[model samples]
Target: MKTIIRNVHKSFGDTKVLHDISLEIEDHEFVVLIGPSGCGKTTLLKIVAGFIPPTDGIVEMDNHVVATSSKSVPPNKRNLSMVFQNFALWPHYDVRKQLLFPLNHHRYISKEIRGSKKERIDEVLEMVGLSEYKHRYPHELSGGQKQRVALARAIAAQPGLMLMDEPLSSLDAHLKQEIRNEIKKISLNVKSSFLYVTHDQSEALSLADKIVVMNKGRIEQVGTPEEIYNFPENPFVARFVGKHNLLNGMWHDDVFVVDGVRWRKDNVSEAFKQKGMIPLRPDELKIVGRGFGNGSGAGLGDGFGGSVEGLPGVINSVYFQGNQYELNVDTKYGELKLFEPLGKWQVGDKVLVGQR
Candidate 1:
């Protein structure tokens, strides 16, 4: 493991923030820690970067124990670079000077290493695709470009690991995705492990080799994007990672009973009977004409007196997203929302639904 955390816990005053957090990150892997606000993702990243000491636990990089019960190495000695949400670039320095300021301040580069500093500056500038703007001040660049400069500075040090705390969250969505690709390319080129922290699920899903999903200051689920999305271990994960409809169901001879209706299994039949869930996705539901084309069931089973047909629902709201129209349907399953292509969808239209 390039980076390892064992039994890490943190508390501020009486409130505990991170609880027994432990994870292993392989060298060169871009791993992301994702969760909602106040989940301690940023705190965990800081612990690895040696910005703040862990209350209790072990932090090791390359099998060298950096922080433990008694000893805490300062950030400079740990051989890591960190990029924050706010661009910590110096206002007084131009791009070229800002990138080299770290080595000059830390005095980490010896006379022998100093000979290559100019080429190193050029190398990292090109690495971040900012060779053309090496002379521009940070204030002259756009939000995404400033971040690139910050990234260039971090990479110029050529640390073994990089810690990012929502570095792209400040950019607009389109620019965020573009910079995200640049980040991915940079990680591949450097082959440096990244401990990324973000609340945005899309960012995490697109960048991470493995995602460590956090919730309320604890590790909830850790896996590849597909595993986290498809086989979520519990309700919190099922709802948090993607779109889902939560419905209560009872097991009845391998079938599930919801709202006094039995749902037959689409897969092989088995003997199961207990209280569980039936996750019905919106795309799984179909709209039958006459509000009644029962050609196939919706994504899930459990249609009540409507005879497993599309239940009647009114359009409570309509939102036009770029690629699709998000419809808020007021139905028996509560006010459920679904997305479809933009069209003549009124707020008072009677609609039918089906499942597949």
Candidate 2:
């Protein structure tokens, strides 16, 4: 199904929440809406699901208007399925009953179909790798298993579009990773359009064919994972999507200067002149042993060579992050965080920071 949202706005009392939000979900594409809490991602999803009417604009499915400012098609009639953060399973019903509940309620299977309801239930259970636990109740399964049942229930409905809201937030790290992969595979096998909502950047980056980053109830940027991460449209996206060391400086004569240090600037537009924030990822900056041109002869000689120069800073703190050490250094501008792959540096150590 192709979903289109155009100029959708929502407000409650006097507070405005979504602002002229427009996006399109292509057929069988997995699109993710990502933002912080209270950013109106869920509100937008609900609008698409026909749970509420928008304050303005319209939503369409396959070029057919399903919702507008005054009217909306009921959620059940939209031929779409939803999986919520909570499993929303029936505690009294067993796994088979839960999986068959949607199919039975909607009368999706006809009498002329070759397979019975139990057979169809078993098929979805096997798809989710929960066939052995078909007879188990909700209380009998683990958290991950219960979530799998929720996903299975939604899939069994055979909706053209599926909406998921943070379906794996409750699981542990390992289980979250496992289910994320499962969701990717399931989407491929089902060949249905998926509209997912989450605040986790990693999930959006890993799962989405297209990512929509939201902030303050507005669509900040929309692009593929690589485009959004590498070329953020603005400062908020640059700061929110990944770990970055933002440096405030002035652009002058094709150079960006900060704290008496100069770096060559490239591809900056003319609109940015007096001041702007330069975002540098962790890998872009490195720590060196000696200051640039200080002549102290205290160089670390870790293959940095002479291509890169150093910026002066003192180590503020050090954190052990398994493979590498995350060091917070206090520079003239502000506190900058960088990753150190080797060597041990203590707090209050005056070190030279450089860009690779």
Best by TM-score: 2
Clashes by residue pair, model 2: none
How well is each residue in 268-334 modelled by candidate 2, as lDDT tens digits? 4333343466767676787855433323222334345654345667887999988899999887677
Across residues 150-207, which tens digit of lDDT does each residue of candidate 1 receive?
Answer: 8888877667788899999789989898999998888888856888998887888888
**Residue 91's lDDT in candidate 1:** 80
Residue 269 lDDT in model 1? 14
Error of 2 at 258 (Å): 2.7
Candidate 1's C-alpha runs over 4 A off are: 103-115, 251-257, 260-275, 289-311
lDDT (0 to 1) per candidate: 0.76, 0.83
TM-score list, all predictions: 0.85, 0.89
Q: Cα-based RMSD of the predictions, in order?
A: 4.5, 3.5
